[model samples]
Target: MLQDTIKAQLKGYLANLAHPVVLEASLDDSAPSREMHELLHEVAALSDKVQVSEQGVATRRPSFVIRRADATGQGMAGVTFAAIPMGHEFTSFVLALLQVAGHAPKFSDDVIAQIRALPGKYAFETYVALSCQNCPDVVQALNAMSVLNPNIHNTTIDGALFQDEVAARNIMSVPQVYLNGEPFETGRADVEQILAKLDADAPRRAAERLKDIAPFDMLIIGGGPAGASAAIYAARKGLRTGIVVERFGGQVMDTDGIENFISVKETDGPKLSAALEAHVRQYDVDVISSQRASELFPAAQPGGLHGVALESGAILHARTVILATGAHWRHLGVPGEEEYRNRGVAYCPHCDGPFYKGKRVAVAGGGNSGVEAAIDLAGIVAHVTLLQRGSHLKADKVLQDKLYSMPNVTVLTEALTTRIEGNGKNVTGLTYRGGDGADHHLDLEGVFVQIGLLPNTGWLKGTVRLTDFGEIVVNDHGATSIPGIFAAGDATTTPYKQIVIAIGDGAKAALSAFDYLIRVPATGEKHAAVLETAAK
Candidate 1:
């Protein structure tokens, strides 16, 4: 049954829809199909702009063919909804109807020209999950692109309904886009990224021109909050700054909820990432996207330029460098773990814990992160099972005390997670072994692997003095062992890994770099010219 308030709201939205739209629902006699049909029928009854019709033959299971409406409420050349479009995708579905009705898409002239120039027919198969909050961004972006270009067609498939396809394609996360038959980008890819992917020669062209780039005053590595903040701060100081990122937003893009960013009480990862990007865009920071730094060459002499070679064969030289590359959660390498990632398995409890409210979940490992995640999940979920393979928990005494005090928390020691079991679409449960070598099975909604974090510093092994754990060693002023190069955020030796901490780290690094630039005399007038330009 549809919520009355939601139905009312949708009715208003449908009434204001400029172009006519029809819902061609095709369902079998199955319970799920019948339920979906009734839901659509109820929705159609709300507004004259929306009309529903039943089809005898179903092209896909419990599918709805949304199309442009004629005077008689008939449509053709429409988008298909293979499952009940709920969660974040509901808005995308509404927007798609509007797009089909001849509403002009809001794309810049540059993006429009790129889409128009795309050769031949290309199909964008976007896979989404109803619960994924960021799925709509990619789906809507593709939908808008489809409307602007005649050669491009977009189809959205609900990953939950097409579990077989999800498993076959190894789509661990939502908003996974497939261009033609090959796998394209994952997660929320911007329209520019999509266009770049569409253009096959873009990488080669970018690679060929890498050496022709100008040097910058500050070259910030990574595009996470720290890097973004550093870039903005450096740019505001009138320094010619540039940021190189494999993808913008860094690890923030993979995250979900961002609560403790100061002043902001609530915000999702994608939203916060978008804000960070938008803020950087307002500055004069040169954003080099979709490129990874392969090598870092420190200055041979004092006040000399430090050069970083990118994977794209482009080398960027800067007087100062800031390392804000973040870390990623370490996975438990168990069977089905990778397949069910973001399905019935998750890493960040802060990000995905709310999705499993009132459901049973497990936290692997007994480290500080594991115990903390278990404590956090116990508040929202019905129960939290903490699994530790070691003989003793590695978390602090205070954290262990808090975890023990929680009634909903269950602690299992000397346990090994043998496998993660899931139904093709969602995680059903998991198999583990107890201390006595006895097998145990738990019917859980989700599993959170919180073994630990691995800092993204493999590429900086030789260039920087790193701790044994690969975190860059830094001082109180965010200065690394090497001069003219500073480290910040999760990539540094900062004890705390919070967003606010990372932001402060970024500010510190940028300020330290500015101080170094003022003291050091580098070779050539390029740096002087940049400073002069900034002064003007």
Candidate 2:
């Protein structure tokens, strides 16, 4: 009965089914089985080409199979839904049914060939939450891949239902894919990335090739807008520059709004990241992606070169190293925070705030980010509650004044969030303790955690001069205490952590490094003076 409206919608979609499609829902003693059975029957009654059946049990609990029905009504297992496909995943489920009835869109010749050539039978299990905006793209891509290759089977599972499996796999985020029972990838990726992960020899070969690279004239340590800007600048000057990044896009990848990026207004994170990467690729910048820097070795002398060691055991040498490794949002480690992430608990308000329109929400942090988020959400949401663990709000007085001015905003200082209360589906409320040792509960549909910024400079702790908070300390020129090392972006002591500010800092670091390379001579080498004389 809960899915009655969805069933009616699915019936409308199945009306034009040209070929027979059979659906088999595996039932158990669970209540979900009865719900699925009723929904399946409702769907079957709509189209003569549609058939529904039931099985006793399946390898995965609460499973359903969709296949092309033959003349005798028998069908082979084609695609499986390990959980009920609802919310964003419902669109993917509908597409899969249409594809089963010979209404699938045609893919490129190259892509089809590659999928068809994939060797052996590989089972792909994609874990997804109901509210993730990016999960649908990944699920649809996998569905198409499954259609192209019979040897490859794709199963979609709702992360909420299979809590044991999620915890066992340590899945903190959604849209995670497991191939043949091994962790393959997390987050949304293009078709090429999926294929690369499926290739057994691709990773080994790529690592071996990365280990053979020569020393670069300039090296950028991250791949955010800052690193991208630095790489573009250095490469334009004909410097051999390389950017090493765990994920090309850095913190900007998780950002959702880009109204502040100058000259261009109203863009999202993924699009801007793509543009940044594309611009860098236009030049000869060696974009070394999916690599994390673990250790930094400063040069013994000026122009001698520094060394950066990656977690993959590949060491890279550079004349100058610009640290652009951006920071991650500090998460609230309370119970249900991780469990309900993207379900109702979100970090970036710009990314997930629109989903909470007209819903009551809580901002868990009274700092600048938290206060700003509250001010931003007050106009959109039904109500806003700002919770701070400290005795007073850590935000600027101006921001505090603005938040107080909002009619829908409520501030609670000296409040510590103890637990986020949510059903397995989504967050329902939050429990916190006040300064008086009294506990309080707030009914809320969403929670935004924005306490403070933590720079991604732990690796440079002993290598360079860092502040007490572990942020890399740099001068106006973005130059660190080490001559050949510079830092920029959120990792540095830059006052503002905005994207535009980071880009400007990146340019400054690149120019400063270039100036140093031209003016200072290496130990036991004297090319700098000769080059200076030639310039004169």
Candidate 3:
């Protein structure tokens, strides 16, 4: 199943195993099981510390559990892989093997404590697809949690391979997690978010823990390209840099392909996010994850520290703050959209497109995301109808040309989606206004809403100068209205919201902040004048 180069790489990685590890497989007389059997034996051959065995505890056939050789427990006490765990999940599988063999997982001490202290028993089943970029985080998080705590058990299921279970449970999205046989979450969740869900007092504990942190010379409010870049530059300047974010990758985690990142020819979102985080770790930046900023308080006096209040009820102070909160996918706020979210109205075509195989679907928008989704769906679905709110497609010429060349695609310009039609259980069609000033509807099984992104600067309102569309207004130097405050990436007034632009803008914001720090006096209380000058 694995390539020769991949096998050699796995051999090198598995050599880190501190103790003997057993691959306990419960397989059946099926082709996938036969393939899995061959794969496990091949892996066991690579590493002396690894071995394969059958007749181990298992509740699901065609599945395996990575466990310590001396473990004594039930089937629901360790990391189980019900899927092939190839593609995006391969890293997670390798990590599970190492972690089970006494290799430490990459998690904070506080999170590790939370996982070990989790009360009661938890049986987590995460359904994922191999192509899903967002599944690895959830799968790896659960696997790590299970390895840390004997009471927690996690099983990763491949939704595509197990089509019967996906349909029986009505699972339509990737990274769908179920706890103790009931649905827990239907989307991507980091380690902190999952801990917060299981432990009711987690937020209060986190708030208390955050209060002890000393004020940073530069604090970044996001963890995307902008925030990562800013952290690197500020740390290089010998400034005390810290990053407080809800998630490390932001919307970049949801992205798939990135061919326009300057140097690297091609890379995916998760891979790029890992590189960004790894790069940031090389510096002295204190990276905090899964804590959202609820409010922004400007510096009281010139060169004074700015206060950022988090949703966890903790307030952090910093001498300079960078608002690189980034953006999220804009939704079509039409009727029945939310009601049938998992049933039909979906946002990520890569995640939910497989559920509508051989069925007609509609892609709402005329931009790159919509056109790309339409082109992708043309191969799997019977037909794809792309609706553009504008007179013409706003996508790049190459994408538009490819979309127009598809045989199973129909494009409608100047079309506005009015409502998402659903039959309570599943999506049926979509209603839209045609270019001819008439109401039109298309019969389809699913709708993919991919208009654009909405900047995540809602919390900065009243604290910083903002455009009417909620983007933080900034100067060419990336400084916001307040002297010590700055913004970048999709949340700022930058014309382009590309990753490369965000990276360069982040460096600019960091330099601007460092310059402001040296220029302003510590006791200079000129907040009002700076605001006035920034307004110009």
Candidate 4:
């Protein structure tokens, strides 16, 4: 049940309903059903525009459908939530109610139009955990689509509440989506990504929209802490700034706890990302999300535009480019790793750890990430085997001590993952090499890879100077080897990749770029010489 303060807030939010809304519930004699009934009763009391009805039966018990009072099935397929939408999903539930009650969703016109014109019928059921930070976006998006188009129907199911269905489908990850009873996608997916999967022309249409964009004074390729900071600084300097990234957060979106950010006592990744994005939007920066940059073409001349190609086949031009395309979790590259991915192999311990409750699992790597994952899993999983390639754990002494205190966790030094063993459907165990150089198998239900991260610099090959490990090399001012092109964050040679460091690096790169822009002549060349002299 919602608290008094939360109920007051919910009542305030429900006042925005333009039309009367009904919560049609189907209940059974179960604890969850009783809880659901109580929640619905409390919610209906808070708003005159909202009421609960047990008249119409739903497909699932302890579930309800949000529908407009005047709308029929032909107009809109109601959005369903099969369990208590608390934790990270509370916002999703509230948003769905507002969107279904004639309030327009906060999305671009083009995106909304695409959803309304979606061709075929889609019955989507997304399995999510209430604790998952990334699940609400998917649930809310699908729910919005259902409100937009009658042909699309969305059911957001809490995996913990529907354990039987999750086990039957072998769904071991949060936000596991199914379309028309078939596996569709797993992990976080935005509106654009979902549309790309459903519509054949979505990509082409999206690319065409960017074909006529005007060149910007500063273009940032990434939307992590680095890219966001750079965009804000550039925009504040009166420079025409833009951002081209698949998502605003990149790797930061996948992060869980972020207590190290200075000035902020404690925060999570999504919250921090939202704050940064809100700050950026206060300026005149153009953010092109759900689009990944695939190629980088340097400027042909000083003050000339640099061409940045996207995976969607669209190319955007900018006067100065800031490379902040962050990094991603590095896979073990061992056999069966990819094959069993999401089938008992996962990288995010926070998101997928609960699915392995009372089960055995293995944590790969010896660094902070691996040790932290092991410590977390120790509370949920039955047993955890920590594997480290080095002779000793590289985590801090405090973390090491905490990990060792757990009786359910075991650490193995000089252990290198060789292969992830599975029975074609789910992971059965894993093979690793000990200090004796002999491979040994550890039986487990899941394998959590926390080895490290690799920079998102693969697309920059042959375009700019990169280290052997594929990181863009930069000086103190964040200037890369190429002129008019700066880099920052985990994608660059900057050491100690942290959120605060990335933000500082982004500001430095923006200032350096401004300095270059003001001093460089509009000649056809000599841009590289300016960078060389500045480095000296």
Give the C-alpha lDDT of model 4. Answer: 0.89
- Scored by Cα lDDT, where does model 3 land? 0.88
lDDT, residue 284, model 1: 90
lDDT of 4 by residue, 393-453 (tens): 9999999999999999999999989999999999999999999989898989999999899
> Tens digits of per-residue lDDT for model 2 on 255-308?
655788898879767667868888998999887766788888777678776778
Error of 3 at 283 (Å): 1.1
Candidate 4, clashing residue pairs? none
Q: State the local distance difference test value for candidate 2.
A: 0.79
lDDT (Cα atoms) of all candidates against the true structure: 0.80, 0.79, 0.88, 0.89
TM-score of each: 0.74, 0.65, 0.96, 0.95
**Clashing residue pairs in candidate 3, if any?**
none
Q: Give me candidate 2's TM-score against the actual structure.
A: 0.65
Clash pairs of candidate 2? none
Query: Looking at candidate 4, what is the lDDT of residue 27?
Result: 91
lDDT of 1: 0.80
Candidate closest to the true structure, highest lDDT: 4
